[model samples]
Target: MTLDDPTRRRAHRAVVVAFLAHGVVSGSWFVRIPDLRDLAGLSDGGLGLVLAALGIGAVVSMPLAGALATRHGSAPAMRWLLPPLLAVLALAAQASAPLTLALGSLAFGAALGAHDIAINAHGVAVEHERGRPVLSGMHAAFSIGTLLGAGVGALAMAADVAPRVHLLAIAAVTALALLAYRHLLPAAVDRHRTAVRAVPPTLGERLAPLRRRWLLACAIAAMASFIAENAVGEWSGVLLRDHRDASPALAAIGFLAFSLAMTVGRLTGDRMVAALGDRRTLLLGGALAGTAWALVALVDDAGVAIAAWVVAGLALANAVPIVFRAAGARRPVGPDGRPAPVPAQALAAVSGLGYAGGLLGPSLIGAVAELLDLPTAMLIPALLAASIALLARSATGGERLPSTAARSRPAANASPTPTA
Candidate 1:
């Protein structure tokens, strides 16, 4: 598609709308969890288990989501998937029993996994058509939505809105956004056009061999970044409250800073990636994130630690998008005559592993904090991010640049001319 093409603009708009809805709703979910806990009369440990259900469900569903996106084009899957997600979101807010919330959380997680894959698959196709960087911008929109969602939910909570009411409002807004943009999603062409054919597989044939070495490497990078980021989300507040004696209200600032920084970073990421290329972008981002963790872990001053945590968000902004771009970058035709490693699969694998680490990060950090201190616990994330930088460096040949021809491609759709 040419830069001036109308269809391309519409496709981009559709993606942005989908992203904004998904982000805001998802962010509000986090903000409302405390209310859910209060309504259920659960303790921190019990609440943790309930939250873990969401992660487990997401991990279980990701592989299936990838397969679904492969068989059905992303647009079709999204139309079917989102309404159910909205229903689950509503159900979660209204659950009366722990068991009910658990079930709702599972459904919510599954929906999220499916939505994540479908949207990314859509993005891969869009980016391919756009020729330049579109993936990062789409992701950036998700962060922006997250920030908005969280703020809205927080405001409602501060105003004494019930969890159900707050969630219902978010759902209404998100559903409206989805409806508004639904028309712009890519229409179903031959699902096989991108590469993978939808033939039934034998019992053993269902599992495709992982041949795209680069994609595997991208997953590894994703694993590192997600693990570190989720750790901060799960543990930073605890550190502030426990070690620094900060009030619960103030402790929340850690995540706010992280989310806000991440949003700004993503919004500007495409420009950076377009100019500097992926390898260097990852290198710089990884270093900044690692440094942020290190400082937050070692510093005693609460203000300093909080500042460091906030800065960490900026460091992390581009890493995930770069990894997504790497995963999504398939040879138009792969060597095996099959569609190359698609973004859906990469996202699934990476998200699954990353969520697992999200669970582990807190547990490990808690153990270390028990033996030494919370600051010492921070060291683990710092080191983990630093190590990820090394892996990314090796994966990308330690700072290779994009080819001149690749750089010169029209800043629009990267697709080949359509057959008449």
Candidate 2:
């Protein structure tokens, strides 16, 4: 219940609100899956292909999402982006053609990716302004939102509400949340104006910060951790039903447990990071995640396996936020006191990679599960968590370009002001 520092409290609240919206919007789609499959008369593989289209859209959109976010600021971009998402979700629910559904999925994915980039970019900005670690808790709000959305959607389904209708209700809820939250969302504080670009600045002096090995390693760790988180969130229900011999209702509980545990973990992550430091926290997370997966893969009992899934979710919850905070704080300063490199943009690029992996998680898990069984699918997350732990940083400074690197900096847009 204790929020972060008061200076960035509004930003933090905005992040939590946006994430809650994401949970409802994203979860509403999953809630409608049975109807979508029936409406399209899709075989299991066929339906999966449709779902894969959503992932493909997210992958394709991430880079551009980052650029747009940087240029426009998260406030304006998110305002423009979310409406389309609701529309697309509705369209996907009602589409008669596979092509139409595919298109809707693309829009859905694009909106999701765009929202993600804008919000997280905005988050980094807020974190920079606050000079502390708050990203993990914001992300934890996302996990909580997901859990709530899924839970509400499930209850609607139990009451026999049609998928399309259920989604309409969810959309209404999201819209109301947006309206309620609009006034509270923070505006971009970096006031210097520059021409927004369609393509991200690839060669700007700003790109200098990412030249270090540390940045690359952190990026890779983020990618791997995100892949683990997304795979479990998206596929845990499927695994339970298909491999563990659970009823649909029971299988859903597996995902709920996973989501709820993740939420609780993330909610507590800021405190953990404060106490344990990012390195030790990452190490502990990796061990817990790996052990949980190992249990899932090796165990035959349904209840025990579900418990393991929850453990994994909790273990993996805060890992990515720590990585993002580290990445944002990675810029080496030059001697003259200017940022020697494009620190924000570099973090954005690394985040782009992480987002891509997250989008890929579901399809990759599905493909593996199709061939090797659910236990094998579960192993992917274990391996990924271990890799992330290996790559995670021991310590990092706040976003200060080292004094040595500051010597070569171009004058700020005005007085060499930081990025928006």
Candidate 3:
């Protein structure tokens, strides 16, 4: 089942398509939330609950998605879920009650959870097959797709398109695009040394890895990075409008600038990683992000803060992808004295923590803003982002400067060591 060179290249393209598709689905869905709320007949409070339902579903499914990928192979598991995931988007558009809308959101979140893990699992495999840093480009595709989907959704709204029609159209188009391009790497490519668990590990066994310095560092670093990212997307506009005295229209540009900078940063991230190496790249990114956030918080001017936000976006761009690179790099030694597949559990542990940070970080900042002030609360992300530097070595297990690929090659039969 090993992919030949042609198939490997194709799989790499497929993985990029998958990431883009997922991002489009997400971006399109977020833009239509107001319509969804109207269709569901919800107040702001009910909308919050429905939103919470989505997080709950993601929480519940993330681990389960990892387990499914472990058992069935990420390739097949991804294929199985694609249709249902898109279908949920269409179905949610039609939900006419609070409960039904919540349920549909829950379904959508579950699908998202599965979709994320499968794609990452498959993506890491593809990276291995290619002997280069590829995740950054894949992530860039996602960022670009988000922008594209958001634009489409905005246009749909302007055209007075119904939610049902707009969302259904997005769902159908995304599904077709993914299926048409999904030359996914065979499950065997990643499964070569994996020992499929016949029974689930005990609670202690599951918890044991968290105590590992590397895993703990990875989790903290990832959570910190996500908090910074979510903060940029969620709170930048508020910071612009309320604190910086910007017009609403001008305030909206904060996140757009951030997103655009992120897109550009990730598009060039692979080159940076190759030139500077994982540990150094993260260290520099962390310092830059921390400085950017600090400037945004401390500066009184809107334009200055917004410009700093762009710097923050650029700094945060490759941070999480590098963390994931470490998490998926070389496999642990299995019982047979060979490199095992990267455990799917890593998916649950890493992404689950990140999901929590993304969900809670904005709320936590908002709470602090309520209790104190917006500018003061903004400092929290500055501190959190700075912590990435402190945690970088542990997170990356000390990747060499200038990333010498031959020095970290994987076991026989697998491709070169990941650039992480």
Candidate 4:
């Protein structure tokens, strides 16, 4: 109920650490992409294929990860999945050929996807048990971790450290963090156990939430948000450099501004959600992101475009978190009156679609840019953001939890009568 509760405190800390670890490993890998490309002597198309392996792997594993979490609980699933992922990261760092990189990317992506679902499941469960909004702050930790990892990687690059050495260091640190926080994770409980033991539902029944209109809408909204976010991450620098003729150093500023805005927005997201409610937050965020993109599309000034990117990041910061929280909270109840397939399964479905959109968005933008122009191609995410705003209500399922103090207060009219 409160941080004074040890279990709650520990769970919260563990979840944050888990998120940080995921981000650190991912950021470290991302920063070394150019080096990896050079090492493999891959052309742009070859590199694209190698990166695609990662997405393919992630898409395939997301549902399976959800199933594992549902059966064994998030803690055990995370504990079991993280080591392999770390190993894969190390393997990827050592990759010397296109084929090896692609294979490593596939394994790395699978591990990352599974770890993501498990950690998010843990975060949602912790939030529910604590009975207050926390998912946003947890996501903020992830953003911070990413920035930290990227900073570290940049420093390593400046020092001319080998990719293998850098990646090994990241793996070691991540492993240490995992070991340190392992005890704090929520203990695994077999959801199958009951006073009267029940058989697990069939796969069809477990996945029934996928057919629900509300869930489908949430997934679509998540996809739209992801498309916007990934577009900025992947193409903002190019847009500035190629279109605006900004210097290389100046061009990098766009992504930096975007990342900082995202981190700041998420850090303060809980208060906003408490004040505005999920529906309002989603509406405002989507509108803000759409408007920012429109500004970027309409304006030609580099500085103005960078500022727009920052606004876009801030606006889009909480979109995915809101979608995930709603999915976990509103999972369908089974025939036995228990949540079917579990929250993780619903999260996985949403995340899978989002990941697909994220991976496809930049490539789609590139194709459209070739067909039309970069500015016009950029309008696609703006439109997507507007769609998210229009559909915010349906996406969030209208679920709103009261503030902590409100939830903790006893009803005034329900005071207990004096007992003899």
Candidate 5:
């Protein structure tokens, strides 16, 4: 489809809506973790284990979701997975026992993992159709949704609203969003299958790309980025309240600042990529994120620490998306003249490993905090962000930037090799 096609435009809007709903749902859960911990009567270590269960679920489900998307197209897979995800979200919110909550979290995480891959795959497809950068903008919508969700969650906390009520409201909104955008998603037939029409690969072939050097590098970058991002989302509020003596209402401000900065960064990310290219953006962003974390580790003032969180958010906003775009850009022709599972498999592998880092983050931090202190524990993500800065070349992939003229033209008419 051409960039000017009205259908393509509608699809773009649909994807943005989907992303927004995703962000709201995610933010609603994340912002309420402190409350949940209290409700379940769990220690920090216990809560960390619950969070780790969620990550494990996501890791288990992501590859299967990717395979499904590769076969049946992203839109259908997303449509099928979303309602169950919403249900699990509500279920998780209602759990009173630690075991029940952990089980609910596992289910919730599985749904989120599958839904994430499908939605991202759809976004990549839309980007290909439009022939310009849209993933960052779509992610911006997610950030905005999260910002709104977190803001509203904070208000609810201040008003003494119950977690069940708050989560149920989010579920209702998510359901409405799905119904509104159901028809706008691209049809399964509209998706571009691999160039060759051979039978699908066996499981071994589907996973072959995991051994490639470039794909492994991309996975590591994704892991480090997630470690940093998830650390802020999961711990920022606790740090503010426990370490900085902020009130519950005020504690939410830390994540709020981070999400707001992320939204701004993503909204402008396309232009930045256009000017500086992916490598430089990753390097610069990683440096900024690393510095922010370092400042947070050293700074004693709560307000200054919040500012550091915002700076970190702005810097790391585009890191994972850049890696994803690079993964999507790779399209290897197989010996049978069919398309290999390079992009889809690479996305799943990287996302699974990356999510593992996110899963480990809370527990790791809690353990470190028990031994040392929260500020000292913050140093781990700081070091990881610095590692990302040093590893920025992984995103470059030795590819030339697409010419402006080429980018503006219809991608359908372009060569088969994908563009990042």
Candidate 6:
């Protein structure tokens, strides 16, 4: 909230690490899943059962994140949650059986869910505090991080680096980097000033936002976004290598293309919101992604499929961020004209639901693929992309980024007004 502090800019820059680190860990783990499967010596069905623990852990721990983010703000949560998150990766790397792998995966999922909620809450806080839309860019950092982690994974494989060693090295580097970048916006000054007060929202008050129509709509829209996003993100590699008969090297390009498109879309998302407003931005994103998925469903060629992934990357860049920003901004303004402290709980709830979609998305695709083929399964994402229409009037009507003049005022005056 210290708009004039020299370190304020640094704080914004620092928050991106939370997102980037997560993406790196995730990308690294995803590429190394085969190693994990082999280490555990599990059949595909057994591996699938253990993997469910990850989603379960993520869902179960999110509410706890709500409490932490509300009470402590981003810095403490980011700093503390990360080491455990990093440690879990090493634990999973060393797992030698299904039970051990499942336990490690559960811990990893919990940490991942908690960190994701905390950082995104921070991103929204930073966005409101800075008076510009930075969530999109923070998300872009995640995509870039994924690309970097995947690149590292590829290099490690080429050099014959053991998966356990690769994971440990990345975790160490990321943890050290965390120590160096400890200047995230302070809890005292962060716009969620309820931290400074004797009173914070009651549990009922915090939970009340979830009952609202718009928030539910946002959650559903989030589900759709994740479904569309993962259709390509989770499966394109398999589709290319297994279905399209591409070489291993060529199949890797599927992920690269998806990640690059996401980076491009997110890098531009803030400007898109600034120019067009949230409703239009959401509408455009839905249309573009829906159309792209339809093309992917109809087209049978690998080139067309990869091209569709690119389009989906571009289409969904800002969808989830926009929903999250709105959720954080939903509380009523005070009589004195300062904005309400952002309800980290609300953001967490939406995220919990949104991630449910992410968890379901892959299975949904696989189920469809099993019943028919991968191309026909593409229709599911297309439908979900088109279903991103939960944009109710109460939740997201007439929302636009603040004007530069509005943002130039003092902190109390500059606080983002509740939207609903």
Best by lDDT: 5
Worst 10 residues of 1 by lDDT: 411-420
Provide the overall lDDT of each model, using Cα atoms, as 2-decimal numbers: 0.67, 0.65, 0.73, 0.73, 0.77, 0.72
Tens-digit lDDT track for model 2 on 45-114?
5555666777777766655655565565556666777777777776666675667776777777777876
lDDT of 4 at 90: 86
What's the TM-score of each model vs. the native?
Answer: 0.83, 0.83, 0.83, 0.84, 0.91, 0.86
Candidate 5 runs further than 4 Å off: 1-4, 183-185, 188-207, 330-342, 398-405, 408-420
Q: For model 1, how big is the CA root-mean-square deviation?
A: 4.3
Model 4 over residues 1-420: C-alpha lDDT tens digits? 123467767778888888888878876776666578779997544655666687778877877777777667788888888898888898789999989988988888789888888888888777766667888888888777767776677678768889999999899888976764565545442222221114544556444666766667778888898778766655665577679888655655666677678889999998888888888888999899999999888898998888988898889888888878877762234323444344666777778777766655656776777677787888989989878888787765565532222444222112111100
TM-score of decoy 3: 0.83
**Which of the predicted structures, 3 or 5, would earn the higher TM-score when compared with the native?**
5
RMSD, each candidate, Å?
4.3, 5.7, 4.4, 5.9, 3.5, 4.0
Give the number of colliding residue pairs in candidate 1: 6
Q: What is the lDDT of residue 394 in candidate 1?
A: 44
Runs of candidate 2 exceeding 4 Å displacement: 1-8, 31-48, 96-99, 184-186, 190-212, 330-344, 394-420
Task: Estimate the overall C-alpha local distance difference test score of candidate 6.
Answer: 0.72
Shift of residue 333 alpha carbon in model 5, Å: 7.0
Q: After superposition, which runs of candidate 6 have C-alpha atoms over 4 Å from their true positions?
A: 1-3, 34-50, 96-99, 190-207, 330-342, 370-374, 389-395, 401-406, 411-420
- Candidate 1: residue 145 lDDT (0-100): 85
Inter-residue clash pairs, candidate 1: 129-413, 129-414, 130-412, 130-413, 131-413, 131-414
